[model samples]
Target: MSRATVHFLLRSDLERLFTTLTDNQYEIIGPTVKDGAVLYTPIQHSEQLPQGWQQLQAPGAYRMTRDNSQRYFAWANGPQALKPWLFAPREIIWQAERQPDGSLQFSEPAQPDRKLAFIGLRNCDLAALKLQDQHFLQGQYRDPYYAARRKGLLLIAVNCSHPADTCFCASTGDGPHAKADSEQPGFDLCLTELDDGFLVQSGSEPGDQLLEQLPVSPTTENQLHQQLQQALQAAKQQRALPSLPIKDLLAERRDHPQWDDIAERCLACGNCTQVCPTCFCHAEGEQVSLNSAVSEHTREWASCFSEGHGYMAGHQARPGIRERYQQWMTHKLSYWHDQYGRSGCTGCGRCTTWCPAAIDFPLEVSRICGDDE
Candidate 1:
């Protein structure tokens, strides 16, 4: 219906897509079955995708089941997406060495990142990727590391037909369909998986060129009928974040009793921050050789729950779990709006899924900030 190029790839010819990326020298990463769950891993062949398997997710529960339907990308998402690849969990930003005269020599990592093709990307993660780009690539100071990795990256998004119970991107307006704009933050190509084939829409020049080489067919009206409805259907969620100005509400309730109740249940294990696609808090340190001759400046992911992360110049800003929880929630839901023009959460619900405390985040937010204003 739109001006985007649409094509159909039969179930048997899925391998052509892999071959195209490989020929273009892009390393393929896709969802695979690992350790009883679906995870992103190196996928060279089409057979490596977790076909017919769907992952069921809740606030703190997860299970994988096989439907034997031979469909690829039948799941919503894994614990993490797109973040780790662009933003390394641990990396050496620059290294210093002691010279012969006891002077210091510094050097930054110069290796260019390999081109990457991410298959089965979800729309919620796509939204988060745009936010990450805003943080790293669009500001006064640009991060060379994130910029280098994102330069040659190719995104092959998948529309959700079997989203997890934890998924709430429908309410966030970031999921169930991938945007097809080449001049904007959109996918290179988006695929909607059906029983016998995939409905593919090309969104960029590289994606369009790739489609021209593949053995795809002009989709028929019959093929476009009921087969793709589930993917197009707005995915419903059991939980929803209150659609109001959460900033003033959270500012008003900074010391509310609800904070105490949440602190009692929150383990402050940093699980939520670790899995959060948009959280950018990190700690940098200098690693030195035992002889103190050579040193390397490195940065690693850090969470607000960490006591050290709360340490300010003279004292700790957030000394207790209550304050830490409040800070995380407020920053994610409120501060992000002030900073990014949108909430930090894309509503993928990974923070709730991987939380060991079994904390339902949206429910907690509602209890604390939902209409009793």
Candidate 2:
């Protein structure tokens, strides 16, 4: 669809959007303030959203403050992305039961049937979801659970007009502004928040239907120009990538000394992977009853920082924190390109913000790549 088809929604009618989704039986999940941070939570109405709230995020630090600017989503990105909602942290893949004849019966567990509509998804998160889809849905062995949850998934992407201090989505080419192409696997509806209203564009058929129900009018050319300018300004405020080619630089810097430096400050707490939108590493194990009568196979999110993650027959592949951290960085920045034809990271900066050790990835990349030059 052309940009001319885009519409403008008055700020007062925001609640109508929520009501429309609810009327369609779509559970709206959006950003809300909870426990001193903006978190993605279920919201029944627009009032539940974090209004006039802003978050200051840096390595090993996060502070939420009141903006009082009438902006509902002044915060860039939060601790959790779309990952936890789509790919559950802990899920039972299959279950087994003991029969009277002493034979075990195996059956797949029922998947969640809830219809989820993600509101306020940033452009980078939409890209991360696509990357995740390549692994879970497009792979040879499709995950039935993920497929079920993804079937009726709805995305309402919000363009990043206020990039965080730790954000580098502009450098990674994943965000700052949501993609406008209708053919892309992007948002159903993309919204650019202006001072008084939103410049909204629909990317899919369902989004068009929703837009038809909203109180909106055709967006003016001047409004579209201002929207583009705001996105450009946001991109300029984000952290920039290093001058060197990251994929090649990291691939060749396997033995860089900076890895050891990072390992020293690293707590191996797995907070980075936990908050990373694209990190999909997981481990599966079986839970058995006391009498071993029944066993349930379960899968949960795993971290490369975990010691046992790299365990083999008799030894750990990455016995040291240096090796483990190196493996994670390499896989995310370099090897992922080889496997998926794109970088795994969306540059949301959640990893740096949530890390207790305050490890900055952009600084690390510059250190390693710049040292070689």
TM-score of each: 0.95, 0.96
Q: Candidate 1: which stretches are off by over 4 Å? A: 1-3, 181-185, 232-234
lDDT string for model 1 (1-373, tens) is 2336578899899998999899989899998889887788888999999888888798888888897778888888888889998899999999999999999999998957688999999999999999999999998989999899999789999888887887778877787667665466378888878778998887777877777777888888877775456745647667677776677888788867889998999999999999999988899999999999989999999999999999999899999999999999999888888898988888888889999988888878888887663
For residues 27-91, what per-residue lDDT tens digits would candidate 2 score against the true structure?
A: 99989999998789888989888888888888889998895699887888888879998899999
Off-target runs (Cα >4 Å) in candidate 2 are: 1-4, 371-373
Q: Which residue window of length 10 is worst by lDDT in model 2?
A: 237-246
Clashes of 1: 0
- Candidates' C-alpha lDDT: 0.85, 0.88
